[model samples]
Target: MYNSNYYIPDLVEIQRQGFFNLLEKGIVEEISKRNPITCFEKQIEIFFYPEYYRLTKPFYSIQQAIFYKKSYVSKLYVPVQITDRKTKRVFLKWMLLAHFPLMTNRGHFLLNGSARVIINQLVRSPGIYFRENMHEIYSNKWSEKPSTSFRRFYADIICLKGTWLRIECDKDFSMWAKMKKGPKIPLLWFLLGMGLSEKYILNSVHKPMNLLESFTKEIEKNQRAKTFKELKYPYVSTSKKAWEQIQKLFKLKKTLRKSSSKNTFETKKSSIVSSSFTFFIQKRTEEKYNKNNETKSKKRIKNVQKGDPKQNSEKKIGSQLEAHELGRKWFSNKFMNPRTYDLGKQGRWSINKKLGLTIPIEQTTLTALDVLMATDSLMKIEDGFLEIDDIDHLKNKRVRTAGEALQEILSVGLIRLEKSIRLKLNGNTKQTFIQKNSFFNFHALISTRPMNGAFREFFGTHPLSQFMDQINPLAEITHKRRLSSLGPGGVSRDTATLAIRGIHPSHYGRICPIETPEGKNTGLVNSITTYAKISVQGFLESPFHKVYKGQVQKTLGVFFLAPDKEEHFQTATPDLRLTSLGFLPKNPIPVRIGKRFVRMRSHKLALMGVSPLQMISVATSFIPFLEHDDANRALMGSNMQRQAVPLIRPERPFIGTGLEARVVSDSGHAVLSKTSGYVIYSSGSKIYLYTF
Candidate 1:
């Protein structure tokens, strides 16, 4: 019944596109964002703005690579332009970046003569996730572990590239900020260290006067303790110490300067005049214009005098402010620096979408505003004004495609390359040698080993990497489409909790619930549903028919929606009374809208029609009368079908699933005639045909 216009998405499209994207634009984008590499001196800036890139013919064919035990790779060359800041000249050169591995038509890579597939990694999406923590405490006298419990709320601002920020609230309603495994800092102290004023912090809090007065009492009481260890604010003895601690947390360079207060006015004035105030008159000569001009000049010189108590007090204040500014910069760099922290477009979008923020997506780092707003949201969550995220929900998780995986590997390689380039830039003394021979020596500076090693490490040792299943077409397709939650950024088997390993309602249509393995990988690994596809945001979505006034019309069109999106509408099963026009449900039908179950009139519902085989994967869907069999048996049947060997005398099943033709056609086993012909001679292994 399938027509040319009736589309069935290519099962292996994700893998194919992931590799092609890496070849076409992934490398360029990664390098472009990290463009204008700077050395420690900051005098020379090297730019890797790729004009364009192409995949040249592979050095060896796939067959040859497999036979010779060699990698099937294509040389990647990019035209890099280096702008000499000192010389004010730009030089363009074509450099061999890497010999990137090539993917075959079967959506696999030949890495060191072995066929491997990068399994899609399912990880928690980068965003602000609010969670409530419950701590159970027991008294020693009770002789048991669970005597009492306390509850607290926290929010995590997770990043794609940088350190994660965790905001926690204590029993006293005081907040704390912790950066990934670091000691926690009082939120008020953190805000102050980030350059926010007391007034601003007080205004942002609900009870300003109360919080300040309580904090003041605690500080006063703790000040009397013999040692700093007795103080509640262990890390921060003073506001200045808070700033210093913030600086230390980020490992920023020491920017606080010591000003010599003992220098005489003449010494200070002379140094200031020679080094800075060149515009001021050196001599009180007769060349002056008027008395007003001379008076103004004299006043300016007096302001520069060191012993002027006003100037001295001002310098102290200026120095403190300078240190504070440096503290703020160091703090901001932890979340805002592109080199240190990057939220990425997806992360930025998730944050904006969840928080209802209008942050530009291109600004792919958390701003102070983003943090402040997220903190406010966390406060609201504590008060039950907002909901905590379901960590296992598909909406909160995203797929890491092969392209993204490769991008991360390339990023690591680039970092290594940057370090080497910096070392060379620092060592070379002759400036002319840098411009002339440096370009030629650039070939040596660029190493394919790092990238190649990274690739090998990923494809060889990674948990998500697996040898392609060549048992059958279904097995191959399933292997490529497999999504795992056990890779680098995912949870480990030992630490994976029952809640995370259990099947979630969100997996209804997007993931095949019956196809998971029987043991440790039971729910950690899953397959995409027959009618499911990954969205642009890496969310898994399944196609559904839209219904208008309880009738599914062709004009209503097909809507592909993720689990989160489906929650907004009431969806009905496809087995509901179907007519020539569409499904027409009689009487009140059971539908799920949001988290509640409700019975509503068919005409009043914004009905969504599920596909017949939408809830199961392709291999599982091939079983006839699957609805009548036990799920365990069905799972076994599905798995075993893929391992079935093709028989020489093959015959179509008398009673089979409607997908039999499709399976046989797509299996790449049986040969078919291209044009109308008659078999002149037929044998067991040979057939001669007479064409039209």
Candidate 2:
């Protein structure tokens, strides 16, 4: 059965490339078209009165700021420039210490009234990987012997830009298979059975002629054989060699067993005798004397004590012999149970069981032989021992690509196949499914769903306004913007803690050393340096030069160039000229030498080669002072400080308190005073200024 859980869809179709592009593009367009000051005002207004919440008709209150012991006019009125009809003039406007929207050094925005900051997530590079797994085959009820052990090997080719393909095969050499979201089949026969030319198969490999010839020979041999059993048998020479190897392995195993058994027997016998003496020392000494006397009496009665003593001694000797025999039998039974004794007889089989051996000894040896035969067949095919015309079944199958061959193998293994679909905004469209029997549609499914709900909610929407409503409810909008470190396949909370538990060299240039949370997430979740950039290619470029002066030399350097310029080998000179082929070495050169490189000692460089770009100059890319501040802490400060209220005293003290307070009129107007002793105090009914 096809496992949907393991099935991963194409990354290209599912990634929110467009969404990220639109966000950045919209901000740039807004900046270019609108006046900075006017835009700031409009943003502030909208932030305080978000359209989504305003539409719900909720009650609103005017927020105010107070100035203590100062005239309202002096503190509130500030000079501002006003542009009217292309003429600029100075004007006095009522200005308070009201919070305004501020754009952070990072590409995030703060809502003036809400005191929230929005942070964009970091995107990671994608790549392909080969995953290894083991499969178990259970025994059939009818067969008394164990089930045939099978090892399944597979590779997952995840093309970040294209579709994903899974290629698999069993160790049995029966067939090779491929899968995307379905079962497997015999790759070779499936391709040939689909009527694809041998040329196609040859092209799939680095050396086509060898594969074709070997494949042809196997087919020809199978055709000559009358039964499956005959086809399964190896050549006389190969079988003889394999048999000899097996016999040698068996003999070696036997010798090792005999040596081990002798050692164990000696140790166990000594231990048993020593243990018996501890429990029956007195009885054992008496039995020995009795045995000697009995032997002496058998030859001469006079040797034994005369009279009743002689009879009693004889009876005691007989009882002692019986007791000794019983003890010996009891000790033997206790120490050597039937199961334990049988284990020694089982020998290698018992060892194999402990080692979790899946394949039988003989079958394992035969499998190795089969592998050699398969290799030999490929060699013969490469050497041109067989021709395409010799195989009659080639006319029936038409497998085209390596992927198709894999799919065919899976089909033969009785795996089910299904069609995958792609969901489009316009409508739901059906992706064409490849027929197992046909060779035309061999490519795997090419679409995948969004990895998670957060991805969909964040990237799927258009305008920022629309996203704000979903994240912050209209009924109870929060002033705080939630920033999450988690993203698609990103370092989770647990993983983040693990990364910070121990220091690593790779973290030196990538993670911020000073900037981390002081809370539960301390050191675990951290910010990357401003200059740090993740490579789309999934590999970091190290800064090193192959040639310097007259001799080939390596130097630590990081080159910062435009992506396009870097691709064309253009140096970041005044004119931005491309370097000549002769002057440029075959290997990549560093873009720029960072401060870290300058500080590095010559011995350090010689000992441990230069570090990769990701390992240097991390602080350059982030905000100067804010980079070290914890994100959670910053958020808490922003929200908490906004709600802070100043403390005021009702009575003035004899010593000057050096504290000033502002009184506001009941009509929401600031009452400013020049008197130093004037203090603004608030009561239940009215705000009052008391002079002491």
Candidate 3:
């Protein structure tokens, strides 16, 4: 421990109300100050931007590798460095200003995707993982049930125990936290009503019980602790032989080695610039090999309609019925005959009167909202809904439900899952669980140390391990050039720019509910719902996709979860996959048209436009696209609207272990029950009526 003379307050209440300003100033200053190799501010985009869009979840974009040391500076970017260490004194030393040149917008690069490699590696770096600590935090903030969307950390470091580096690979940054700040820079986030957080605020308001206060007592009960098990708080117990033994075993030392050599910084910075072109770091090369066995997975999406990716930019998609005519008029390569569909331009006001609406209804979405409108008026749809976990079909794995089934399946190979468990098969015996052979299951170190004393239930081990061994996705943003120099960074129009998977604005729409029929006016008339839209004429199937200013996390139907594998250094990985069951109706609706497609409304999530899945979820429910540091739960609390419940609340069923959806209210932001159109694949199935 350092001399007691210099006391920097154990917890520097980070109390400077002008927080956004402070952050803005700090970020701008940092980026500008570290120009050149240490570029600070960047647009901070994901890999590529899709032309079409929707909102099953924020389009997936890996954090291409980002490299910067203390010295290099000068670039247009907002630099924010967050490092956790044992001492406040050494924290700043580890900060790095990252510069990402590519995002999800422009799509793939010939060379190995830089961001993907870096993010994965950083999070997976080996070190003493504070797995238990990260899981403890997750549990306190989120439920144990495998959430469609959840947060896990990659890595973190602690100074104690001889300059220890504790990477809690289990904790993933939360998009809920990231989306809070009004649309500003990509990473900049606002802790709206910082005191209103479920993890801290609510817990702190009623009674002031911090982590240390509650757990201190039990940590002492078992005095024969291990090296890492030193009690984090003062415990109420008499000093005894056991205590002596624990002390003898854990002679914690604050490791304060000389600052990492300046050369180390230089090497990393050089690597940053060198990385832009092509990096052959053994570190990088070997890592890719580890997952060489992994294959690119594509889901067997049924109702998915192929897109024509070569339409002219001037012609807005879904604008005219003769879109096919336009295709022939424009591109020599013809695509979807605009006659059948103008790629996601349905649900619009129509001069004709076949669809049965006064004006025209918005058919711009493929969501539950669309489902509510799309299902034949005569069909009876249920009022209540179930959670649909976005599952990785190839990886036949079930999410962690609020039960012992997941663990049982993991350990014993399967659990009892019967269709009529509640009736014929002795409800208890009917539950069936089967395990597959392909899940990348690993035992995590974080799961070993139990932070919450009694809550460490029997099946806690696996969760704890999953929390620790989760892989870290290392993403690198390679500037357009392999080694583009500083003085000049300009982009040419149509010269694809790098951006994360984000949603294109809903197809330029005059109204929503373009497809849904109007009812007795709530004082509003001559209007239809503006369906979630997309311009799918040319850019339909881009790797990444998203919509902008989409509804907040209204229905948490989809999730963008990032896993980490490193120890002590809680960074996030970039395996951004969408997880949520699309249709979880209590009364299973059989699909009429396609096996892959469902009975829901269909929206084409074109390149720029997001997937209908995304829009519908965001419009009515929650899709906390990004990740956050502290607000470690499903969403940032304010992401959901009360009215969004209907869309987010409906039932559903997916082909996997039974995992239902749950609803959560977010009192953080202002939202309303507004209807929008989405592109969904329509089908036939048993339907229930939940009419107003």
Candidate 4:
């Protein structure tokens, strides 16, 4: 009837709910969408077995172990079944053994019989984050007020695979792409490369269709008379031409450095500088001269006001092209690889080289095109286009889903997917196989050894597995517990505790107040109350009073006995009758109801907001005598008693069992003997004693 290895009933429900939560999140749907033939059903079963232990010896047989070497081993295991949605067929049946990290009942695992708890962690959710900052530029003319510039916030798409694509815009409102050390490509071009539509990309970032239409109209109006063909189809232009267009779009005038003024003048006279370069230099020189004169005049005025002309004359003069002056340019040249320029210094370029890797853009495009063709999103293939090999394969094999194609690409290392398995596997093995790595597998802690036969028989096979057992019953049972702590990528204990203790408003009805452990883990380790339930939709719902005709009717209150009077009263209240008194305050005070008196604060009846009937149900459902003991003390008793050892001592025959009498004379002789009962009286020099 009682089995320690079997999962606790409440824990089983929680674990089942956790799996349903994943299903509700559409993870299975996503996987199925990617691999149409490989679908997953909603039905799942989990089985927990007892801890496994093994003793190995160098000798082949147990009889020969007298002089051979020996060792001990132990572990845990869980069995799982995954079924396909479309075919009503089982997809995978796995017996997860120890060495595989699975969630336990307490949100931890047992390793070598020692309990291990997981910690929660914080991770960036898959979404977009916007960032904006001020870009400050030095004043060109000190007297001319330095123009204030505002750089609009750009959108950064954090792909599900952890790739970051930054969308940068210039004064022309034309967007450019900047990945981690990747060149700046036109935004539209990059989207096309990813096999995504321009409209889809715009909608992903919340861009308005009206704004796009207006921008299109403006571009058409400005480029109507342009003879350049590339101007008409900028999105499809070559990278080099796109870069050149980006340059012309900004139209930043080249400036002559203050240090290069003499060189520029000589070059202008010798006709060494091109017309464009000459114009740029002259424009820069004029701007510099104006700035210097304005700064000097300001200094003179300030000096006159302070009566400190000598200090003004000593002001430091530095070259405009000094190392510090060109710091921004140098930094951008070395680190910022817009358009994939300066490949040698590009971070991704070097990384790719080191890994001997390259993205087969052509191959990716072909694959995308094939998928679109299969789905009829693109032009239909000609009737004779199908080759003999293609026709034969098409007849025998299921079409590869988009997910399958992507997975194949991933396997070839075309793109790196983010590591989702946070927990380490047994033997420190990094899980690379997606099939072996699952949402459930990542949380399961397994052991190899089978549980005791008696324990297995007592708990019996899981209901879902009973039919399978009828054909071939499992020889050994696997034990498992769903862990509560953070999985592989969880936060630390202190952080998790701090978060839980903060008591967010969302936890009001979802978490149980009475079922939390006492002391350090009080609120951190809590159990769901009986009335609380988690729905398949992933929301935790508890009972709430319903209003009839827009009015809440008065509810009767139950009487509860004080802790000291609990022994005298079998039930909290006599005959379980409702009292006229309503909810009472938290302060402890004596109250009379019917023919009994009790403390209102010390009992379940005093719980705020709960109806008397609900309170009675809660009290009855909880462990007996739990209300009488401190929560911390109860928790300590439950866990500590398991590790306690009983001691037995032998009694000594000489030890006294009952009352004894001893008499001593002035001469120093003493006698002791057992007495039934005695009385003594003193008369003159003689003492009288009687024994019965």
Which candidate number would show the highest lDDT if scored against the true structure? 1
lDDT of 3: 0.21
Q: How do these models rank on TM-score, best leading?
A: 1, 4, 2, 3
- Model 2 regions more than 4 Å off: 1-106, 110-124, 131-154, 159-163, 169-181, 184-198, 206-456, 459-485, 489-508, 513-524, 534-692
lDDT by residue (1-692, candidate 1, tens digit) is: 22233356666778877777776777888778667776666766777756486668998898899999999888877777766677576767777777777778767889778888889999998888999998776677657676778787888988888898887776657677788665565565456555565556555654332222323334455558655446554323323333333334222212212244323432332232121111111111111322457775455345644335563343332333454555566677776678898887888988898878899999997776676666677777777788888888888999888878888888887777777777777777426345454553465456677667777777787777788787766787778878899978898988889898887877877888778777787778888877777776788887777777878765756788877788888877655666777657578887768667788777766656565677788888878788899999987887787787757676776766666555545444457677778899989798889996
Please list the residue runs of candidate 4 whose C-alpha ends up more than 4 Å from where it truly belongs after superposition.
Answer: 1-12, 16-189, 196-241, 250-487, 491-501, 512-531, 537-545, 551-692
Clashes of each: 0, 40, 190, 40
Global lDDT for candidate 2?
A: 0.29
Question: Highest TM-score among the candidates is held by which one?
Answer: 1
C-alpha lDDT (0 to 100) for residue 562 of candidate 2: 19
lDDT of 3 by residue, 323-378 (tens): 32332332222111222222122222211121244432333211211111222111
Better of 1 and 2 by lDDT: 1
Per-residue lDDT tens digits for candidate 4, residues 273-294, read 1222222223234334546799
Which whole-number lDDT from 0 to 100 does residue 356 have in model 3?
40
